[model samples]
Target: MIIEEIYQSYLNFLKEFTAFKSISTDPAFATDIANTARWLQDQLAANGFKTEFITGYDNPLVVGSYIVDPKLKTILIYGHYDVQPPYAKASEGQARMIEEDLWKAEGWENDPFVLTEKNGRLVARGAVDNKGQIALHLTTVFELIKQKKLNYNIKFLIEGNEETGSPNLRHFIEDHADLLSCDSVLISDGEIASGHPVIEVGFRGVINTAITLTTSDRDLHSGLYGGSVPNAARELMKLIEKLYQGTTTIAIDDFYDDVIAPTKEELKNHASFPFSIEHHHRVTGTKKLFSENSLDFYTQTGLRPSIEITGFESGYNGVGFKNAVPHTASAKLNIRIVPNQDPKKTVKQFEAFVKNNTPSYATVTLQLGQGCKPIRINPKSELATKAAKLLTQEFNKKVLYKYCAATIPIVIDFKEILGVSQVLLPFGNEDCNMHGANENFEIDLIKKDIGVAWGLLS
Candidate 1:
């Protein structure tokens, strides 16, 4: 295949796809997601593959399959069509117009939704995470098929709800196991911590919890009950504090009991990365590190378990201070667990801890939300070795292997139902500003990723 022609076609398709604002969070973009899925299905069909739409509760999954040889290894290429909402709010003055705030910035040099080539960078939303990556996979397969370069069967599982924790992906996977059965899965959705081409071997799981504590029926005058009543806000704070004893490790019982320590080789490979504790703090603009042992920060983030307090609410906030004790206090928390730690067991332990620690006067309520299990694949798997070798050959740099902190629910479900492992090969940078204002992707990286995909297929 002519590399130049393939790269140009890939870029054109990327721009056209990125123009559609398929924001999964907004109901307004429901049609847009469907349109994108239709376009993708058409593209896959045009490439000489059997295609079908796996309808779900919200958006559907676009699946396409091609069999080169029944005996050849089958690979599942998974990606998402949904994107996070843009930051172009009409209320933010001057930022409303696409040319003004949407475009022209140090990192963002053009409209995030409109593709622009500036300083050899492609500025657009989903350019890298992950419309561009998805396009790369598609173009790679298409070009190979066109040139008769492919030698194995390929299955595409493009989902539309990955951004929202893949609410329906588990059921989809279970229902379509025969259709999606494959030797392995390749996902281009995560990035290397070192900002280099790498294969993600593992991903952490998450358990979200909402806790509410009520001490009284309604707000009470602080002066009248200052000495007698137990403040709900104070009690809630105590409960939360007990979960984190001024240390990075969570204080919840048995939280780490099921955590599987990294292998000796995995730890050695992690140490090979040139990560400076001081430089990380400087880049984050923090005066001090969170972990007691500064060297443990990387482990805590990449391999260890953690509890995070996402939000908290209590009492009133106005011009003047209201002298009243809050009747109810609530907090939102997310606990990230490592491999071997079941999300259900972790949540149960957390609830039990809160119940045992709560005062008799205060009633505690625990609401469990979404939960998923952590996943880790062998670094020496045949597919992983092949991908790493191809990435090194294409990029002329050693491939970095790292664990992603975020959760991809479908990955776990795919493994459980289909018995497949996914390789996360992300083309996006760390500071892509996803789910934030002025999200942008480097144009040069987009082109390079196309080449990388081509090389991987080769």
Candidate 2:
């Protein structure tokens, strides 16, 4: 009945919340980010939360606290306000040359910044990724406070730079340790595996970087200088080809030497999870599985490391042929690391590998971003057990312990800086299409998240 009562109001709130293009990666949306932060603060304050803006950073962080009593246990909720760019930008030596509209190219039926409902689904940029989840929690808190049923001290740290890897997160956590200290932390950002409710026990870490190869100052005519000069694109392509040895293993030295394998019990639990190969194919649009030594999906993602090429820009790709040789070529890469692997050391190894493999005529440069360590939470912790029980009751099915392949940089910061137990309850559907065009969420899952939030906070 509570879910039914709050459906319309929650949908309205989500529509307003998702309209802001609070993209943290690009400075062109600074005003939009500020507006979003203010909107969050005002909403929390209206719902009886004492709110403050954590500033002096790249993007402001919104913290809201609702304390009933000092003796009560505190629950800190973390979510990001930032959404990835609606389109990808092609850059040439740090200068963005083209802003390609991926939304249109990907065949989005509605405006990405406008929340649209079609066939019982909400479509918008960040609808399910983070804004929708954050909106659901806030609406649940509003209802709980109205019904006078909240029992725990609730604190929300809604940040603005998660899409770009939270560069200022470490400093923020260190400076506000006392303010963020809590008995437990709750996060709802990722998707449920195969639409089944899951308690994510661990997640892989990640680092994003770009490698640029420069052979000359300007684009050269391929017809005049085809074999006389070095082609940056060709040289960079050869370098990238050496990044891996076989199909699954990275060729970089010691890349996979530091990963910790899952235990027997953990493997057993993964085998029992409700996984469907058909569902995996439906979501990924591929019929084959790329795993190491023919491992299962869980083992491949949760237990192993991966190197992915996210973006590449070189030469002329236009309506017509330019017949020019590109002077510079750049490739963006994302490396997923497992537990016990140090990010700094891994970056060094990656750098050395590139340098050794690169051609002598070309000059290579590496631009690195922030790195996050992997996290493994105890599945049997008191808070985790409680969450499992609540999730089972809500979804009317047994809860699964998931080893998430994706990374959330702030989760590890919460664990290390606040020293609190954490519970990750995923509420989005597997086909939510986060960080991509036509990103959407199901109305059913939105209601389910509100119900779960009520149970947790109460």
Q: Which structure among the candidates has the greatest lDDT?
A: 2
Q: For model 2, how big is the CA root-mean-square deviation?
A: 2.4
Candidate 1 lDDT, 365-389, residue by residue in tens: 8888778888886678777787888
What is the C-alpha local distance difference test score of each model?
0.78, 0.86
lDDT of 2 by residue, 318-404 (tens): 555789889999999999999889899899999999989888889999999878889888778777788788888888887888889
**Model 1: CA > 4 A from native:** 1-4, 26-29, 69-71, 86-112, 116-120, 215-235, 278-287, 292-297, 313-329
C-alpha lDDT (0 to 100) for residue 22 of candidate 2? 97
TM-score of every model versus the real structure:
0.83, 0.96
How many clashing residue pairs, candidate 2?
0
Those runs of model 2 whose alpha carbons end farther than 4 Å from true positions after fitting are: 90-102
